[model samples]
Each structure stands twice: as structure tokens, then as C-alpha cells.
Target: MGPRFQNDDRVRLYREMYEQHGPIAPVVLPGDVPCWLVLGYRELHRITSDSALFSRDSGLWNQWPNIPADWPLLPMVGKQPSILYTVGERHHRRSALVSDALAAVDPFELRDRSERFADQLIDRLCGRGSADLIADYAKELPALVLAQLYGFSDQAGAELVPGINALVDGGPDALRGRDRVQAAMSGLLTSRREAPAAGVASRMLHHDYSSDFSFQEILEDMMVNFVAGHQPTADWIGNSLRLMLTDDRFAASLSGGRHSVAEAMNEVLWEDTPSQNIAGRWATRDTQLAGRHIAAGDLLMLSFAAANADPQVRPDRTSFTGGNSAFLSFGHGDHRCPYPAQDIAEGIARTGIEVLLDRLPDVELAVSAHALVWRSSPFLRGLASLPVRFTPTPTSAAGVYR
Candidate 1:
């Protein structure tokens, strides 16, 4: 399961796993750590729905004794002050604080800001005739827009991009990247505290429940929100564009008609969601799941991709999903992604894609579609680089879209 997670063709891998082991299967993580993967749609829904039995609190993990201090996955799954591990009443308050802060962001402003940043990024490479969409466009857009939303200047936001990317990639630099992002968030918190303003971080600082938690803990929550928002949204843009470029059904999106953009984005969420798998819920007590004997303190990985592909729900896997939104891409139940955050991600990703198509109407993949490479991350699914070519449009004409 550890090596299979990095496989480029994860769809087939997930299908094989489901066929071989049913909905719940025992597997070892990268560090030889053991856990069960929830692969069935109904099974995942049940686990996420019953948070009392399957808890978010990672401290309940029984394998802690075997986990080394320097374990690569510690930063992700290990107990942390962030809301990801918080549970019960306190978690509810924290969730409201984060959600309200994000919800206050004006949707109109978010869309306009997304377009502005998308253009700025595309403007940088519009005259080059060729570019890596991942590096130049998709990766940088989300954080820049989020920076402004979080009260950071564009310069500060731009500075944080590389570190945020490295952190989400879960590479050797992940810890270092996490440190850099935390420092930046700390600075922002200090600034917002000194002089409050209209931004997500400021709103979070002023939330009624803000006083309940220490400054460090709130800062940790801020980091989680920002990171969670950034990478997945970026991958959404990249993956949706990959689909639009390769699939005939969405080619109309590149030719001035805007109708297919939404379909492509929605379809991507179903077929190739950026968040393919999640670190997951821990068993609070001994329980039976999918006819398997699961003991207390056992870790359960949520396989969103597999769940979405479950034959029981999606009988015809090859059929177009269209407007159906039952996918678990953003998760479900009590711990699902905040509704406001989901809207923000959707706005940024959809606006980014629309703006790109309007600007470079003739854009096409530079290499054979088969030549594109997926980033080798077990948790994330996105292209390492989406090399593309288009007729050069001068920077001076950037605002003049088709």
C-alpha cells in the first residue's frame, strides 16, 4: 500500500485494492506503520458520520510507542494543536471561528482577486509561448489570493508560496517549509493583533472563542487552514486543466464557450480530486467495521478516491458524473471541509481556469498527453508539471481576453 500510493495510475491501484480486499483492508504506511483503509462509499460515510467511535484525536493512536520522533509522517498524523486533532465541544467552537472568518470573505472580491492573480501569473509567461503550468500558474495563484484574504501583502504572500508548496509535497523540506509558513503566519497574527483589519486572520483573532485558546494554538489553526486551502485548490486547477486539455468532452472550454468549465471542474472532483486520500479517523473503542475486527486505537485511512469509485454507488464508473455531487472529495459529516472554505476553493479554481482559457484560447499540451507526470505524493494527486504551448500573447494585451 505504501508504494502503491505513489503509483501514477492510482485509479487502477485503488480498484485492485477494493477487488482484492473489499471495503476495509489492512495496510502498512510508508514507515511500516499499520492502518486500515476505508474504501467503500457507505463505509467511509459511516466512519466519518460516527465521529464518536472514529475520532479525529490522533493522541489515541496505539502505535505511538513504535513511532520514532523523526518519523516522516509525524508532522501530518501526529497529535498537533491544530483543529484537525481537536474533538467535541472545543472543536465545535474552533470550527465556527475558522468557518466564520473564511465566510466573511466577500465572494465577489474572491472572484475578482482570483482573476487578477491568474492574469498576473499568466502575464508573466504569456509572451514565452511555452511554460510549465504547474510551476508558473496553478501552484502560485491560490496562496497569493489567500495571502490577501489572510491580511498578508502580495509580496509577503509570494514569499510564502515556495515554502507552502514544499510543505504540502511532504518532501525532505516539509519540516523546514512548515517552519517558514508558521513564522510568516506568526508575523501576520502579530500584525493583525496590533492593528485589526478586514481579513480572515483578523476575523479569527476577533472571534468570541478566540480567547479560549492560546495564541500559538490559534496560529496553528491558521496554518492548517491556509495549507489545506492552498495545495488542494492548486491541484484542482492543475488537474482540471489537464482534463480539459486531454478530454474531447471539455475541449469546447478552450474555444470561447464557458459552459464546459464547470462540468470539467465538477468531473475532476469526482474522478481525480486533488485530495485523493486523507490521514484519517482513529478508532476510539473496539468496533467492527465492514465485517472486520478493528481494535481500539487503530488508525483508519480515508480513501476518498476509492470511495468515490466504489462500484456500489458508481455502478457505471465510465459514465459522466455531470452535476451529481455525492463524491467525498471534500469529505463528509461533522469533520468535512467547512462549507465556506469549499466555496473559496471552488471560486479560486474555477476562476483560475476560466481566466486562463479566456486569455490563451489556443493553448494545448506541449508534449504527448502520456508524457505528463503526476507528482509522487501518496496523499496528493496533481501533475508535477503540465507543459503547455500556445500562440504567444503579448503582456501588453493581457487584460484583453478573448
Candidate 2:
């Protein structure tokens, strides 16, 4: 078995393994499960898309002791079981419901709401000179957007953020937070069902399908969607801001009005994807991947960071100046993220960043880059504290984002 990975050691292990061996590497978990970490773009894509061979069902997780049996996150309804864990027809049905609702909603409507939220957040931080990017901007934007989608009040949205954060960033106390989040989410779904709103929650409550979905099942799906949609997005926004503020070339391109901020946002998504590792999948049968033999029941973990950074796939990948590549920050194929509103959120974020750059081009990090603490979740990557020093941009006698 490999050395037990402490919370701090996973990133180092990932970096060292990626730097030494190309993308895919064999790893033995502390639990003695032999797993292949698929890192290369091609391999990651293959494993994630090949649903027949790799199963998302939590059956494999039974091998590991860390996961709880009554884990609120697991899917317990439909033909195939497990919330985010099921596969095949059941997964397809659940995904269709989400996609349909998202499709019915106009992206522009979301953009308008996000822009307003961004403007307010920027106004609050405008004269402060420095603020924690995670707290003030990154965390706030996504929560508000989610609230709008769910038709929840701003206060409810704000309350969900810390619980969501705690659930994803597992520690000794994560279960406590997870329990609270689960209960709150269940309550929210119950309320939505009792008093329907004109939002995704209402849509889900009324969604008609052959499969029967219970309140708990619906809540689990919503919770997954909530976390998946916001957490990584928030991380990407925080990381992108940090990168642009420090790198003059990138910052200049953003502020110069030369390259579109939309393009820059894409570059940020491609360059610094928020999610580093995806959950493990079990191989149903023997398989050959990257010239390695994988026995049935073996686990595979996809590394979005490694795939995005692969030189073979993204030549000149290190140069974040610009790129046309679509990053797998949202995953690929059957497992693709359901929230299509990201483009809307990104648009709003880009506009907000542009406003910041235009108003305060000389803004620099309040502390050295090294002093910024990176978030420790293996699944998510972001700065916990991104302090910056900028001459407060004069509240444009005109309004913000005008």
C-alpha cells in the first residue's frame, strides 16, 4: 500500500506524479485499493465517457471505510441507485430533467441577475481597498446565482454557502456540517413542494418521469447540483482573479479592451479549472487503458487539472495568454455538469473583473502570492484568502459595470 495521504500530501503527490510520469499513474490508496489516476486529456476523457465500462455507482466505495453508509449525498432512487452514484438509464433520466429545466430558462435572464449581484458586491468592496476574494466576491456570486435559480431568498442562499463549503472540504467535523446541510436542503425541498415557486425547484417537483423520485432523492439531487455548480465556479473565479491581478500581461489584456473579457474567462476556465479530481468509478470488467491492464472492480480517478495541463493535448498549455481549447472543468460526456448557467455566471464575472481592471489597473496583491493559502479540498482548488491592495477605484460618478 502507498503511504497514507494526509490532507496536505495529496496535492504534492499529484504534482510529483504528474511531473514525473505523464498523466496516468498507478496508485494504491491507504485502504489498499489499487486505482489508476487518469491524468492525460485523452485518458481522462475516455474513462469519463465510457459509461459501459466504468460505473459511477457507489458500490465500489464500499471497499473504502471512510464513506458512510447513510451518506446523504448518495442517490437512492430510480432504476439504478445512488444520487450522483447511479449510471445508465437512471442517470440519463435524472440528467434529462435537469437539462430540460436549464434549457427552458434563458441564459440572458440569469446574466441579468448575476450582473446585478456582481455590481452590488463590487460596490461593497469598491472603497475597502482590499478584501478576501473568496469571501467577498467568489463565494457571494455563485450563492446568489443559485438562490435566483432556486427561487430562494438571499438570506437562505447565504446560509447554504458555509454548509456547502464544509461538506466538500471534509475533515473531522465535515459530517456535522453535512448533516445540517442535508436537513436544510430537505426542508427547502419540502417547502418548495408545499408552496411551489417559478424556479428549478418547482420544475423538479412537477417533473414527470416513469421512475418515482422521493423527497429525499430529489433533495440529494438538488444538493449535488447546488454544490457542483457553485463550488468549482467560485474556485475558478477566485483563482482567475488572483492570476490576472498578478500577471501583468494577462491583466493588461483583460483591461486593455483588446481581447474580449469573454475570451479571457474561457482562458481562465481552460487554465485553472476549479475541480482537480473527480470521484472514483469502478471498472465493470477488465480493461486496457494507456497500455496498462485493469482488472474488474478496479477504481479510476480522473484528474481535470492534469488533463487541462497536458502538453500533448494543449501545446503551449502553460501560456495562459489565450487558448481555444474547451476545458473539462465541467467534466465530459455522460457525466458533464448539468448547470448550463455557467456561461451566464462567467459572463457576469468577466464583466465584473473588467470593471475592476478598468477602474484600478494598478491593483496588486496585498500580500505576497506565496502568502495566499490554497484551499485544501482534493476535489476543489482555490485560494482561501486572496488579499489585494488597490487604490480604491473612485465610485465612478457613473454606476459600476456601466
Which candidate ranks first by lDDT, i.e. highest? 1
Runs off by more than 4 Å, candidate 2: 1-23, 60-82, 171-173, 253-260, 339-341, 355-362, 393-402
Per TM-score, the best of the predicted structures is 1
lDDT of 2 by residue, 176-281 (tens): 8688777777777778778877877778777884136777677777777777777777776787777776666565654456364555567666655677776667
Off by over 4 Å in 1: 1-8, 396-402
Tens-place lDDT digits, model 1, residues 1-402: 345566556777877888899999899987899999888999999999998999999999999999999897776698888899899999999999999999999999999889888888888889889999999989999999999999998788889999998888778997799899999999999998989998999999989989998899889899999999999999999999999999999988999878899999999998888998888999999989888999999999998999999988987878999999989999998889999999999999999999999889999999988888888776778989999999998764436322
Per-residue lDDT value at 246 in model 2 = 63
Per-model TM values vs. the true structure: 0.96, 0.83
Could you report the Cα RMSD, in angstroms, for every candidate shown?
A: 2.2, 4.6
In model 2, residue pairs whose N, Cα or C atoms come closer than 3 Å (at least 3 residues apart or on different chains), thus clashing, are 74-83, 75-82, 75-83
- Candidate 2, run of 10 with poorest lDDT: 72-81
In angstroms, how far off is 95's CA in candidate 1? 0.3
Give RMSD (Å) of candidate 1 vs. truth: 2.2
